[model samples]
Target: MGKKFFVAGTDTEIGKTTIACGLLEKANQLRLRTLALKPVAAGAERTAEGARNDDALALMQSASIELSYEQVNPVLFAPPIAPHIAAQQAGKRLTVSQLAGYCRGTLMTPSDFALVEGAGGWRVPLSGRETLAGLAVELQLPVILVIGMKLGCLNHALLTAEAIRRDGLPLVGWVANRVDPDMSCFDENVETLKQFLPAPCLGVVPHLPGASPAALAEHLDISPLGY
Candidate 1:
C-alpha cells in the first residue's frame, strides 16, 4: 500500500498542481515511486489523440510512474469554465461516485506516493447536488491544502481549512505558494496561517518563473508527509 493524499486549494489558480508536482518530485528524490491523478479538469486543448489538459500533463511528467493522459485526467472538458457548467455544455453529468471509482482503479497501481488533485476549490460543484469535496470524502484520503499566498488569503485559507474539518477529513499538511509577487505583509500572513491551520507547513514556495518540479522540490520538506 502507498500513501495517497487529496490535494485541494484554497481557491482556483492557487498553484495546487505546482505544489502537488513539487511534492511528487521531492518524493522521487527519495527514490519513491509516485503517481498523480486529476479526477476532473475543466480546461483542455484538442489534441490529435484527444483532449489534453496542461495541469494533468505536467503532473504526468513529474511523476516517477507513467500513466496515460486519460488515466491521469479521467474527466475533461474543453472550455476553461466551472466543471459542472462545462459538463453540462458537453451534455455530460459529473458525479462523485463515478470520479471516485476512476481514481480508486488507477490508485491500485503500486507506488510509494500518490496524489489525487482536485479540480478547483473544495466546494466546486460536480452537479446540481454534488461537489468535488464529496469525492475526497468518498476516497477517505487525507488532504494537503495549497494556499495561494496573496491579498485576502488569510480568510480564504481559514475558511477552506474549516470546511475540510467540517467534512471530517484529516488535513495532514499545507503548502504556502507565493502566487502574488507583490502582496503586502506576506511573511505576517504566513505566520498567521501557521498559527491557525490544523496542520504543519510542508513548504513555502516563492514565486519563481518557469521553475521545474525538481527546482521547486528543493524548497519542500516531505518528511512531514512521513517520507
Candidate 2:
C-alpha cells in the first residue's frame, strides 16, 4: 500500500492537472515511481487509441511508469460538459463505489506515489445521489485542493476546504493556480487564502506562457505532503 493523494479542484479547469503533473515531476526527481488517475473525464477527442482526454494524456506523459489510457482514465465521455450530464447522455451511470474501487486497485500497483484526480468540484454528483466527495471519504485518501485564483476565489476555496473538513478528509495541501491573468491584487488574494485555508499553500502557479511540468515544479514545495 503506497501513498496516494486525492486531487480536487475548487472548480473545473482550475489547473488541477497542472499541479498534479508538477508534483509528478518532483516525484520523478527523487526516482519515485508515480501513477496518476483521472477517474472520470467529460471532454475527449477521438484518436487512433479511441476517445482521448488531454488531461489524462498529460498525466500519462508525466508519470514515471507507463499505463494505458484506460488505466489513466477508466470512465470517459466524449462531450465536453458536466460529467454527470455526459454520463446521462451516454446512458451510463456513475457510482461512488465503482469509482472508489477503481482507485483502490490502481493504488495497489507498484508505485511510490499515486494521484487520483476527481472529475469536478468536490460535491459534484457522480450518479443522481453519490458525490465525488463521498468517493474521497470512502477511499480515505488525503486530499489536495487546487484553487483557481480569480474573482470570488476566496469564497470558493474556503467553502471547498470547509466541506472537505466536514467530510473528515485530511487536506494535505493546496495549489493556487493563476487562472485569470488580469485579476487584480493577486498577492493580496493569495495572502488572504494563506491566512484562511487550513492547510499550507503548496504552490502558486502563474499563467505559464508555455506549459512545462518541470518548470512549474520549481515553484511547488510538496515536502509537507510527506512524499
- CA lDDT of every candidate: 0.94, 0.89
- In terms of TM-score, the best-performing candidate is 1
Question: Which residue window of length 10 is worst by lDDT in model 2?
Answer: 100-109
In Å, residue 34's CA in model 2 sits off its true spot by 0.8
Candidate 2, pairs of clashing residues: none
TM-scores for all predictions: 0.98, 0.97
Question: Please, what are the lDDT tens digits per residue for candidate 1 over residues 101-136?
Answer: 999899999999999999889999999999999999
RMSD of candidate 2 to the truth, in angstroms, is 1.1
Model 2 residue runs over 4 Å out of place are: none
